[model samples]
Target: MLLNLKNIYKNYGKEPLIVPVLKDISLEVIQGDYVAIMGPSGSGKTTLMNIIGCLDRASTGTYLFEDEDISEMNDDALSDLRLNKIGFVFQNFNLLSSETAQENVALPLIYAGIHKEERNHRADVALSKVGLQDRTTFKPSQLSGGQKQRVAIARALINHPRILLADEPTGALDQASGKQVMELFKALNDEGVTIIMITHDASVASHAKKILHIIDGEIIENKQGGAA
Candidate 1:
């Protein structure tokens, strides 16, 4: 399994005022899986995604990523796992305002100790894959919302991560732009890139091969063959 979470629970605050976020969450995702997690605001889906992406740990649970116990890893280890194994896409694009598209895409490679020459080459290739090769030198301000999101996607994939975790990827786009992003996601999934996307929109979720509906800190439904 690429990922496994058993009896997961997350809570915050002190003993007398503990606020539960996720409750008894158990899930398994294998290689090449394209899954969507659908939930309304305050449903704990973001917390679950944080755990899956190694950004946070469950208050109580067993999480195994590629057979390695995540609970046993330290912050540095978890950070390393996140840097090397997982790619994250956010609704806001998260690009450096001063950096060009190529520079933004190559940011992760800098931390990986890749030389400048190789970093630029890899970033260009990633941009090409996302159909943004011609926009490599453009800054975020120069691109449209959809183009910016594509740049984010290319940056996320630049490291060739084991899984792509997208949090409301299309939430910031217009109807047409969102449709284009979903089509790109489908293409990436078809190429065997595992994807786990979080979205409240049913139309956005339908792009995945499987959908997990979350409500009240619990998974209410697990539907298969979500894609049309």
Candidate 2:
């Protein structure tokens, strides 16, 4: 398995005033798996995504990423793990308006202490892979909804992460743009990229090979999917 979670639990506030957000969540994602976690707002999908992406720690659980127990890693180790092994795509497209597509894609490399030349070259290659070669120099403001999302995808792939964590990736786009983004995701998944997408849209979730329905912080369904 590429990722494994066992008996995961998440709670907020003090013990006497504990508010649980997740309960007994266990999941396994093997290499090349294309999984969608479908849930509406307040269903705790984002909280789960954060834990999977290493952005937040679970209140209690064992998370094994690539067979390494992430629950035992320290803060710095978790940061490095997230930087090198996981890539995140947000619904907002999270790009800097002042930076070009290439620059936005190269930001992760910069944080990893990569030299500027190599970062630019690799950024170009990543953008081209996502069919955004012509938009390398374009700023976020200059791109359309679909193009912006493509840039986000290119940025997420620049590090060659083993897993892609996308949270509501198509939420901000039009129907046509959302379809385009989903097509891109399908292409990436077909190319053997392990993708875990969190979305509320059933049509959007249908692009994945498997569907995991998360309701009220619990996974209530798991099955082969083609709901589009």
Candidate 3:
């Protein structure tokens, strides 16, 4: 398994006023699995994503990624795991407005201590893969919404992460742009990328191989997707 979460529980606050968010959440994902988590507002999906992405630890229970216990790891180790094993795409394209597409794509490599020449080369290759080769020199302000998201996707994949975690990735785009982004996701999944996407849109969830419905901080259903 690529990821395993058993009896996970997350809570905020302390004492008698502690608020429970996720309760007994058990989930597993194998390599190359395309899973979509569906939920409405205040459903605790974001909190779940943060734990899965190694950004936060569950208040109780165990999480294992590639057989390594996440709860046992220190902050630095967790940061390394996030940098090397997972890529994140947010609802808003979090591109640096001051940087060009290539520069933004190369940011992760810089943290990895990669040389400038190789970073530029790899960034170009990643941008080309996302059909943004021509936009490499363009700033975020110069690109359309779809193009900016594409740039964000390219940046996410630049490190060749084992899993891509997208939280409402198409939420900010128009219908046509969203369609294009879904197509890109399909292509990436076909190439054996393990994708875990959080979306409220049934249309978007249907694109995954499996749909996991999360309600009131619990996974209530697991259904097959039409695109499987």
The lDDT leader among the candidates is 3
lDDT of 2 by residue, 18-38 (tens): 989998899999999889998
lDDT string, candidate 3, 1-228, tens digits: 999999999999999899999999999999999999998899999999999999999999999999999988999999999999999999999999999999999999999999999999999999999999899999999999999989999999989999999999999999999989989998999999999999878888888999999999999998878885
Model 1's alpha-carbon lDDT is 0.93
Clash pairs, model 1 backbone: none
Stretches of candidate 1 off by over 4 Å are none
**Each model's backbone clash number:** 0, 0, 0
Reference-based TM-score, model 1: 0.98
Candidate 3: where are CA atoms >4 Å away?
Answer: none
User: Any residue pairs clashing in model 3, and if so which?
Assistant: none
lDDT score at residue 23, model 2, on the 0-100 scale:
85
Model 2: number of backbone collisions:
0
What local lDDT does model 1 show for residue 63?
97
